[model samples]
Target: MTLLLSVALFGIHSLMFYLLKINTDSYSYSLLELYGFFTPIAVFIIIVLIFVHRKNKDAVGYAFMALTCIQMAANYFMLHPMLQQNLRPQKINFFILFALFLAMETIITARILNNKQ
Candidate 1:
């Protein structure tokens, strides 16, 4: 699930950049910044989730949902200004993409949490 989500996001991101004709250098730098800042925190959360899952699957699922929410919030806060300044023309597209991503994430998380397994 995670791998699928990652690949989908990457493809969408790349397509957005291509279709919008965004400044690749600046956009790439921003993405690098986001990755560098969030990767460690995301890894730590996943590690903890793994441990928690062994004890309580539901708890881990909720944690994953919360983690996804936090990540979306952080992305919005961190990227909004950059999008406004650099990708002004494509800002709406970015927001739409982000909203779609969040909706998909929420659905996926809910499904995992509600699973009887």
Candidate 2:
């Protein structure tokens, strides 16, 4: 179910961005690349969360919590170059994609974290 949801969300997210790009071409930050890069990482996180939830239910949340800091650093690294630029649209695109995927990842992790009940 997690994999399926990720794939579906990936498609929808990609398609939504493409449609938005069709209307205006100011966005050149390679937001799709950002999404492409993180999608797999997100899946891996969910998988590890699941395994931890199974092997050590008590550690699943800790693992994810620890992972969140790494994620923040990684996200900053990826956006650092873009941050140097003064393009508002590119920044907007980056945040939109970032928030969408982050929310999805959070929901998946929340499901795993709550499964202990």
Candidate 3:
């Protein structure tokens, strides 16, 4: 499901970028590259969350919160190159991409966390 959604998002993002004519600036990763980079992380994070929930129900919430922060930090790492280059366009694009995945991840994990076994 995560992979499917990520592919869907990648499609939409690609369409939007094409429509808007957004170009990848110097030292900035392209949108396709960004999606590829984050997709596996998102997929793995969900897997970890599932395992955490199954292994210790009580710890799932804490794990979710901690992992979410880690995601934010990961986003920062992904954007650092653009930050160093002072590219507003790429930074802004990254922000949008991050927010989309963040929301998707939060919703997916939140559902898993809230499920009472």
Against the true structure, whose lDDT is highest?
3
Task: Give stretches of model 3 more than 4 Å off.
Answer: 25-27
- On TM-score, the stronger of 1 and 3 is 3
Q: Which wins on lDDT, candidate 1 or candidate 2?
A: 2
Cα lDDT tens digits for candidate 1, 3-107: 455456667767777797777564424543443554454555556666666679868777886887787787778666766576654455445555755565556
TM-score of each: 0.51, 0.77, 0.89
Cα lDDT computed for each candidate against the true fold: 0.60, 0.74, 0.82
> Which of the two, 1 or 3, has more lDDT?
3
lDDT of 2: 0.74
Off by over 4 Å in 2: 1-28
RMSD of each: 4.4, 2.8, 1.6
Ranking by TM-score: 3, 2, 1
Candidate 3: residue 112 lDDT (0-100): 90
Residue range with the least summed lDDT across 10 consecutive positions in model 1: 26-35
